[model samples]
Target: MSVLLESRVNGANLYRRGKVRDVYEAGGDKLVIVASDRLSAFDVVLPTPIPDKGKVLTKLSSFWFGKTEKIVPNHVITTDLRRFPKAFRDVRSLNGRAVLVKHCERINIECVARGYISGSAWTEYKALGTVAGETLPAALLESEQLPEPIFTPATKAESGHDQNITRAQLAGLIGTDLARELQRLTLELYRFAHDYAASKGLILADTKFEFGFHDGKLVVIDEVLTPDSSRYWDAEVYRPGAAPASFDKQYVRDFLVQSGWNKEPPAPPLPPEVVRGTSERYRECYRRLVGKALS
Candidate 1:
């Protein structure tokens, strides 16, 4: 399969090119979101494009948006390319890799929910007995389950890593009412997804969500519950005291850390093995979660 690192829709006006997706404005209050095969680690886009990666991501997000829509409204208008605007409709390359969604005023907060302590949460808990400055039980292990899922909000940084913020701080940034709604929705979505993944022999360790204002109502925007936005681990092999196998970009992050490349722009290219392994991991994640092959 061909890797699409950059999408060329020819006539669609470019909205913005994110680390992994290229968005373009369709007519009316809609946008076409194209998931590219480009993978980003530590907020830095890698040069190598993983084959069929974009299709997996696009289809998986659509799968999840359908599953979780009853829990909350979302921005998706259609995932079917035939229904897209005239310019985007006939592009064969856009078949499974692009979605048409309503344009919304994005809420700049990254709504995070953690069922397990790991990553930055673990680092902070180990050092200061807190996750996002909120205290947790004493002596939690690296990947141990939390007492319950907690909602941790973060800033949506334009570049580099998003910074975790306390719930109260989130309230301060946004109004108290809006912050509470985001927390409620984030935790609820996480719980629903967590339970679903558990039955499928996977752990929904933690995940983040983005929301936006559309037609004067709040709705989930961007991608949801995909490996790119969530952390997953195999249920049978999961251990509390150690770093579990990741079904996300954490695999690539581990490689970068070992390669001793300072986290900076101009990131190093992946080796052949790394590229193939990463591609396999993304595909496997799709297969397990969506209950079908991404093809």
Candidate 2:
């Protein structure tokens, strides 16, 4: 299958090229977001591209934006290609992989919600009895659900890793009023998504969200609960004592860990089986959540 590692949209000014998505100025207070097939693990973009990955991310984010609109406003303008400007009318290559959204002044914070103890939280708890500086109950097993989901905010790093900050520290960075509002919205959205995923037979372990300001109002920006931004596990076989099989990019990360590759920019090429397996996992999550595969 063919994969698009980069997008070239005529008549639009290029904005930024992220680890997976390319942004462009689409004029009239709108921006175009194109999700590329490029995959990244451990803050490093891999050398290989997964087929249809971009379309899956775009569709899943749209599904979630529609699901959580009542909680807070978002930046999504429209995903319907037919309604796009005439300059992009012939760019059928972007049909399922691109979206036009309102341009907002993005808040430089990574709004993360954790419903379970795993990943960096588990690591931190093992040594410090804390997750993002919040004390957790002692003797909590790995992959165990927390007493309640918490809103853990992290700084938006430009080149290095994002450092986790406490609620107080978050308030210091973005002011108490905005901090309180974001914390409330983040937890509300997490609870709503967790309940929905449970009904679908999936466990949303954790997810990260980004927000921005539009005319003095907070609006959800960037990707929502897609696998790239979230951790998903099959509920049927989930256990608290060990890491469960997930629907996110953990499969690829596992392969890389076992390969003993240094988490650097010049990452190793993914094996054919690994690429194919990871592609299937992404598609499976989209099917389970959206009720259909990416067309």
Candidate 3:
């Protein structure tokens, strides 16, 4: 795997500098998205790179594109390093971590689906006894399994972290039809992926997906099912009442939590061991979920 240092798309207009990704205009209804090794926690990017982290995320997203294509259209065009155009071909070194995708008019919402109670869901449940701006049944405990998955949409913050919004708010922004479609598609995709991951002894706790309009039709965009986009927990160690041991970036989060650093400016760099461990966990997740060793 060669690591290309520079971008390939000419007339590349920088679109967004996300915490871990750089999106570039790829000329006419397309975008070149590059995943950096940058790791983020609490909406802050740490000052260290996790080796192979980008490659792992790219591969995982590729795997999921294939798995979920039956459910919805995706932005993926090609992953064959040699197939990229001349501009990108020379940058094959970065091919393992970058992708050229058809750009679409992105839906202005972050479509999230949760099967387990944790994270923001738990936080909201404790305070308001509901998730995603909706009330839930009584007797729900922290980390408990949700009776059913919920569609929790959040505004796609052009800058800074996204803020969660209610279903009604989502409908107001995108019209009731489109909002309902997003919700239905999101939950269906989550259910399919969650069951598949469960079969492999991993728990698909929750995930966020982005969608865009192409030819006036909805299509899934951005990366999916990667550690950076979703939470994975080890099924064997999963206990109902307690937080399950995570199979994704929880290790990094745990380290950060222990560091006692404010979750604000001047994010701290991770120790070498923590980076290695996180990278390994991502690799393990891809291998197990895809049932094939990543090249």
Give the clashing pairs for model 3.
2-93, 3-93, 4-93, 4-94, 29-103, 30-103
Error of 1 at 288 (Å): 1.1
| TM-score of each predicted structure versus truth | 0.98, 0.98, 0.93
TM-score between candidate 1 and the true structure: 0.98
**What are the clashing pairs of model 1?**
none
User: Lowest lDDT 10-mer window, candidate 1?
Assistant: 245-254
Model-by-model lDDT, in order?
0.91, 0.91, 0.82
Misplaced by over 4 Å in model 1 are none
For model 2, the stretches where C-alpha displacement exceeds 4 angstroms are: none
lDDT score for candidate 1 against the true structure: 0.91
Residue-wise lDDT of candidate 2 within 1-295, one digit each (tens)?
4589998878877899999999988888888899999998899999999988898899999999999999988999998878777766678778889898999999999999999999998999999999989999999999999999988899999777999999999999889999999999999999999999999999999999999988888899999999989999999999999999888778789999999998987999999998999889989999998887667
Count of clashing residue pairs in every prediction = 0, 0, 6
lDDT of 1 by residue, 158-265 (tens): 987798889889989999999999999999999999999998999999999999999999999999988889899999999889999888766678889999999898
Write the residue-wise lDDT of candidate 3 on 34-107 in tens digits.
87777878777788777677788887898899999999999888877576545556654466787878878878
Q: lDDT ranking from best to worst?
A: 2, 1, 3
